[model samples]
Target: MADTPPPAMPTLADLQHWTWLLGRAQQMMIEQGFDAMRARDPVLPAIPGLTDPETLARTRDFWTDSLTLWQRLLIPQAEPVVETPAQARDKRFKDPRWRENPLFDWIRQSYFLFSDQMLAQVEAVQGVDDKQREQMRFAARGFLDAVSPSNFPATNPEVLEKTLETGGQNLLKGLQNMLADLAKGQLTHTDSTAFEVGRNLAMTPGKVVHRTDLYELIQYAPATENVLATPLVIFPPWINRFYILDLTPEKSFIRWAVEQGITVFLVSWRSADASMKDVVWDDYIAAQIEAIELIRAGLDVPAVHTIGYCVAGTTLAATLAILAARGEADTVKSATFFTAQVDFKNAGELLHFVADDQLALLKTLTTDGFLDGRYMASVFNQLRGRDLIWNYVTNNYLLGKDYAPFDLLHWNGDTTNLPATWHLRYLLDLYRDNLLVEPGALSALGVPIDLGRVETPAYIQAGREDHIAPPESVWVMTRHFKGETRFVLAGSGHIAGVVNPPSAGKYQYWRNADSVSSLAEFIAGAVETKGSWWPDWIAWLRDHGAETVAATGPRQPGEGSLPVLDDAPGRYVRAR
Candidate 1:
């Protein structure tokens, strides 16, 4: 047995295999080095001699002329300049006594000596005899000089002006904050009112009579109080907190919808955690079903209208398809999506960060335990770094300007962590693999997601200038959905696109009067309306709203056997 174990010695073939492996490893190392170098600083200069091959060979030969002399004799004789004991002692360290220690002295000396020895091995690429060396030196100097701190735009007058502009913006932000605080202080008048508002905002105002592992619903007594004819269920993406639609009175979309004689229930998706990791597309659909069941049971309603935004829009679409496949069409009557993508074939360039390598890194991070909220925020920040991050940084940090606290910015910074399991599945399945678009590429709860089966009328809205989710990305849904769909191209970016109030200044939106028009032809003939699109959207949604009915009974404090698990506006804000 011992003789047999020692039988495999390194033959020429084995040696060759080792050589190949070493070469491959070296190549990968070189590639990685190149990546780091390019990322750090990329410099390209005109090489007059290298412009032509004939001259390039001559230039190369000239530079290497001193190679033999330098490499064989001068290089071998090169010695490091040593520091005296006094000089070494003068070097600052928190633990000065350690410098006198033998180990520390030897380690520092060895490091310098080793660095000098390594430096001596390379023959200088410049030479005295080389006429082309002059150009090479010029280019090298230009490149090196360009990277120096002095070369930065801080020294330039125009750059100084831009810097001042950045400073002014920050000051403006600070002033804005002061005003907001003053306004809030004046409006509140008392801590009691402020507390009430904060308490209202911190928790959901509705109660969850029905519950699932993923989502819950807060049901309110029908404000219409008539026999409830239609039940409306609002679906919002969990990417942000669920309170955007329920912000407060006047601006609160949910409040407005309820006040307009509609029986509305908003879906409160629980923030993901380890337990919810494996939750995929199917779980969301099931949650929607459960939510609808609970809503119907409480309201004693027949069907429900669904409104979904961003990720939840697609989720609702999938739910509609799932219900249709199960022949449960009576559950949902109409659907609306705001800035959600169903077709992602041309989702755009920002998705490059979510490509294989980055996705793999992200998935690996999530695998540990939780998807760091700040990490996800940083990735999102990169999509519009120039506008969202750098512009502010240059103004607030570099320009030494005071910044006002913006409510939106404060809210934006309040990112939520993703459950690692769901995040990985989301990136791999929806983004990189684009399972949503590919036929049978992805499934939820063992059910295939076929957009063609979504026959419910859809009202889709998208922003024209949204770098995060471009208008072209939204159009992808039109190509796939087999429904009577109206796609509206709205003005502004993702946030402004969705929250564009009627009073928003100088708003513009495009609408295709005929919902059946192909996206291409619709783009050709779409009419642009001045002012905010919210008025038109609200009017359109109103027409589709559930008809008036008799008043429903009061929301029972403890309906059936389920008591209110938590107060309205539960601990969602505390998440992450």
Candidate 2:
């Protein structure tokens, strides 16, 4: 009756991210001004006896280089700056206006030159620390991205076309969409409820056999009459719902595994909310262990084929490594990780923002105990701003079109909160410190965690084009493990690479036929496979897991001391 009391305004935590970003841009402007003040044209001193040929030569060289750079940047038919692999993939730059036109090309090239020259100017600062320089560079890039021609109406031919066709109606709709999303405190591009989770995405057949405060255990129904004696348990990243691995019956890796005669049990994490503010890193590990123990107690299984995806894979490695250190090595029969990295030496540019300054600013807001999920999304979208942020800007606003209903994007849009304490730990220990990979350098649950001490055979799968977990970063983990590691390089980006099903008959993968002496060498000599790597993983599991017996009545899901908690895709998943 009271219009729901005019829904409460978002808190300071929700508002701090924009403040931090704007502050970064402001910092960049101040540094630019300082750099400009310090910069001076090459000054030539008068020589007494003889002409100073060296100084003259230095000035001459600078003039020559500057002229060449300017000529190439300004000439319509001038040479173009080469694009990076990711940049070459952007369709917006492929437009004739951007590439073929002289003026547009010059504008684009001049922007690149300006960005590079500014960064060089920052480096030329005598008293600045490397951290400060890095921040300045990051901020400059963000500013350049914000002012990209594609982001505005006058320069974007597509926007002009739409405006002309619709007589400005499209702009009106887009403005309304923007306002609605702003009110909801979301950066959403589509109606999230366009497709229900259980009905369209996480539709795999399963039941919630057990749950703890941190996670829900879903045991899938066995599809084959004779299932492997060893069960397959997955630890998916708590950053998102577990349905990523079980999107639909046809595309689901879990469903595929079940049909292959393997008992699949998944660890579905609870969506972190205000109530979960007190949840800490140790609390999460204990909760997962408790759920696994409940399953073991109920089914009386001796060993499990443990798998981890993304951050969950990182946590799984740490948790299992700790248990193995405590002399429980036999608990896990084998280990498999998908795009998960423990050694962060070569982890992607996401770490660029994990420095003390940035984290300190972020922690100010996290005192409430959980980073707002929307805020996290805003920060991460910057890493691939063109695709994740601006692509939607063009489609949702300029064209006045709703984002197409995609399972992966849908799940991505349905983001959930991250427990602040756990998130901070992950960022520092794994991303910044690189302690997890160092033998004896890190300890968990009071036990030393050394992946080198882990002899459990591991299967590592990496996305060849993964921006988050570069394949090299994931491949480097092989050196840490003492056991034989089979590494597969799948084609595609992070999410699409892992979710690839064999039926799709798209995207090729490569296998290092020989041992891993070096990632580059292995890549050069790697044998290409035509289809999905799912079959390769399943075969490896079958060979490495405990001996299989005719699955007569292996415990179905929802058995054990606890009654069935609920059906698959439980309440925790639908929380958002």
Candidate 3:
């Protein structure tokens, strides 16, 4: 009997040729998809004499630079022919081989040139409305990002090297990974099996004090002997799970607040299904009011401080308005909004998906009664395509690398379904029509909602780089509130800015005592402070009536008026 020899390893040239073929096939598929989309919705209107002199000049410049690059390739020089843009912070082209190898360098430079030219052309379209132009720009950027050289195997030096080093095993593993992700119907941004809802991610000690069709209210066990008399009730956005605030003991804002002598109660929203299709925005507001009543009844407190993150914050603002109209504004002694937007005038890139055509498409897709969680997740991922989508695609599919276990990313991937009626009302009323900020423009629970009439002291926090709720959009919220408002700008984007704890001391926040009319004016007067804004927020709460009292542990079934339903990070959070 003779032993068989192992297959020969592929040469670099062979691998490159194979990758080129794969790239071409992928390009053809992408082009076909784009063509179909354009056929349905033309990106730019055919306006007569729309092309200005600047557009012609930009076209000429693109050709000139492209020709110069070709010339550089033909005639080799000692020094590099072109340098990457100084302001360019893309990590994709960080490999040494990208600059060291003339071929890869040219590919990188050429891609950037094309991206700039395409974006410039989109910007130069003059006759289109602002929203249309913005949509065109977004589409062009998405296309450019999709076709980046770094996304392909042949053009990316690191992927090619890994493929060669592993003798094409990486490609086989990558195929397996892609198939697994496709079956799951979502991209694996982190090691999904590394953490669980109650096991590690949302391990804060608590008991589910109350449960409703809409949410489960978890009352965290007090960490300090003496706690604030007024408890803190948090309403996290229903678009995702609530564990984002309770990710880990270290990163858990819920745990940190408990340790800081604050009795915290957080609402874990139910993941909507077909049965919940009849749920409306008013139901959510009613659920919030119900949670507040439950907290007050169980703890026997007259009022509580409240916090809302993202979309829930918008609802909370409405809740405040409803309370004010009913002469019950004092129920929420103080309100803190975390990266929440009340105005959508400059709502950023997410606005591109809220137009009539896109909404109509969404309506058709949601015939199943609820919008699939994956749909919203895909939209968010597209907002930062390079970081969220392509980065994972390159690692999981191209390089065959598994992502690290990150609690934040784990929480991010745990998406929740949105009821069709509630989601549509939110998009149309709040985002499209910008009615939330306008006094008495919206109503819930049969009360005319007027944000200006709510005089509860507010601590509004905005992420300086937030895309979902632009800081400018958030800043506009300060103007709507007639109460004593303190606007704090935190460093980093939405999730990072809000989940930041004092112990980590990673990013900085800014505060200004002086009044300001606009985001720009606020920034000009604001003073920078190091570390997390949690402590400052705590101080604000204390100043605005968060008095300390003897702390208590999680309540047992017979211990309080509200029965203990379950342990911390309850079943609602565990829902798929």
TM of each candidate vs. truth: 0.64, 0.82, 0.89
Checking candidate 2 for backbone clashes, the offending pairs are none
- Please give the distance, in angstroms, between residue 51's alpha carbon in candidate 2 and its true position after superposition: 20
lDDT of 1 at 44: 40
Candidate lDDT values, in order: 0.60, 0.76, 0.85
lDDT of 1 by residue, 1-576 (tens): 455555667764565455556655665674565556657766543234332333444433332332322222223333332465644553222234323433343334443333333223222342344433433443343333333221234432323455587755644554454465356431111122232323444332456555566666666444445533676788888777767666544445666566556666777777676676666666777788887877667656677888888888878877877777778867777788888887665565445656567777886777745676767667666565444554444344334344554434444555666667666777667766678876666677667778788788778889888766778888778777787777889888777677655544566899988654356777788999986776776577666653666553433435533457655554554455
Q: What is the lDDT of residue 203 in candidate 3?
A: 89
Write the residue-wise lDDT of candidate 2 on 1-576 in tens digits. Answer: 556567688654444444445555665665455445446523544352222444334434433444444455444344545666755565656676666665466555555555555555555555577666766767776776777777787777667778999999989988987788789777775567776778888887888877667788888877777788888888888888788888766788888888889888888888787678777666756665665666666667866788889888887777777777878777788889999998897787777878888899879877777887787777767877767788777778777887676777777777878988778878898799999988888776677778877888899999999988999899987888888789999999788899999999979899977875889988999999987999999999988864665644435665455468799877789886
**Candidate 3 lDDT tens digits, 1-576:** 788999999765565455556655665664465456658877644333233446545645765576555545444463345554641567888888877777887788788888878887787766799888888988998898899888899889999999999998888888899999899899889988899887888888888878888889888887788888888899999999998898888998888888888888899999999999999999999999999988888888889899999999999999999999898998899999999988888989999889899899899978978999988999999999988999888888999997799988888888899999889988999889999877778889899888889799999999998988989989888998898899999999999988898889799999989977788988998999998999999999999775677764333222677777788888988888
Ranking by lDDT: 3, 2, 1
Q: Which candidate is the best by lDDT?
A: 3
Candidate 3 TM-score versus the reference: 0.89
Model 1 stretches with alpha carbons more than 4 Å out: 1-205, 220-228, 248-250, 503-506, 515-520, 554-563
Considering summed lDDT, which 10 consecutive residues are worst modelled in model 3? 44-53
